[model samples]
Target: MAQQLDLVDFIAGLPMPAATAPQLNPLDLLPRRPKAWERLVAHVPAEDVRISVSPTWTRVVVEQLREDGCGDQLLGNGKIRSHDVPPDLIWPEPCRLILMTADSAARIHERWCLEEAPGAGMSSTFRFAQQQHADRTPVSQQLRLLAEEQS
Candidate 1:
């Protein structure tokens, strides 16, 4: 039938599909807006459940903080505060909660915690990540995606 031939012609005229791009991993870039708890959970050290605190995020400054005993905070631009803070601010064992004030400088507003975990250091990246999460910004997750794409 004429209709049958037309159908066959139509099918023949259709182009083949193009090659597909590689599949992207979701974990590569964390979402721009994720739950605050997620970021908190992500930053906390799973093994010890303690977040080290730092007073500043400079090479020389950090060394000083480390020397001063409040130097347990991990890498990043956070100045850990709290002189009488107990351990487990992030995770409470003796419930040594982080003491804080909603204080702000010219360019930054900080919530601080005082801690003496002996030899524990909280990851500042985690703190940065936590702050971002509180603001619902997951921009840091892009690091993973970018690394994957480059690889």
Candidate 2:
């Protein structure tokens, strides 16, 4: 058999991914009180792509990780993947969200979570970047305001 897959059926069967781990900086999901999002971070291939999208690159696999339906999705080569957060998530508080690059250029990445755990105590980290990956995006999108640093 050619290793077949039933993706459509998989996501439907997925039980709204739980916070399988603990939370670190669990920012209250209340939009009015705080604008922070409750992200259940995971891991994958490249955390960010670092593109200048005015001129698109069709074959670039990095951009797909940012899409909503990216999870469990397949590429032309028929491989399903995601990106990983980066490093620097170690050290103590400050910017607990540690972002490390998969490459020297600092384009893509892996992940390590740091969020708030509901009743689990104060906060904890699952170390997803070292374990697995979370999502993917370009350097421009991932680094956000730090593009100049990579240049």
Candidate 3:
């Protein structure tokens, strides 16, 4: 007579399935974009300028500046280009504002120095101007900017 195998013995005899790492989708690796309302915008009273600050780019606009009794005049408007950082690693809104303000002030000071004293060199105090965003700004938006920059 043949010996009967118990249930536990039979189960244990089965081969175990190979353990494989989970496959990641290419799209999952892409950065997410933030909604329009999530974007950060701040007004700088010192410069009478408005800026949309983000981790990937910063937009600066001086609506008007009183220079020698000038009214309703455009002082300057331009974009500050920057590299991207992970949204989770970006600075908070208040910090971003402070940095942006410092950068703007530095630029203005540099210009003034250039005009007043030629050959004078001034460097910005805050180099990570673009790595900050308003508090309300979503992380997804920041990530989106990073992805865009990479592309």
Report the number of the highest-TM-score candidate.
3
Candidate 1: TM-score?
A: 0.17
Worst 10 residues of 2 by lDDT: 29-38
Instruction: Give lDDT tens digits, candidate 2, residues 28-124.
Output: 2111111111132233222221112211223333222233322222243435455433333222221222222222113322223221111122222
Predict model 1's lDDT versus the native.
0.29
Alpha-carbon deviation at 73 in model 3, angstroms: 28
Error of 3 at 11 (Å): 2.0
Number of backbone collisions per candidate: 14, 31, 0
TM-score of each: 0.17, 0.17, 0.22
Q: What are the Cα lDDT values of the candidates?
A: 0.29, 0.29, 0.29
Per-residue C-alpha lDDT of model 3 across residues 53-126, encoded as one tens digit per residue: 22333324232222222222222243222343334432212222221333333333332211111111121122
Ranking of all candidate structures by their lDDT, best first:
1, 3, 2
lDDT by residue (tens digit), candidate 1, 70-151: 3233222344333433443433332111221112110121122112234444222222222211432232242233234333
Q: Least lDDT summed over 10 consecutive residues: which range in candidate 3?
A: 114-123
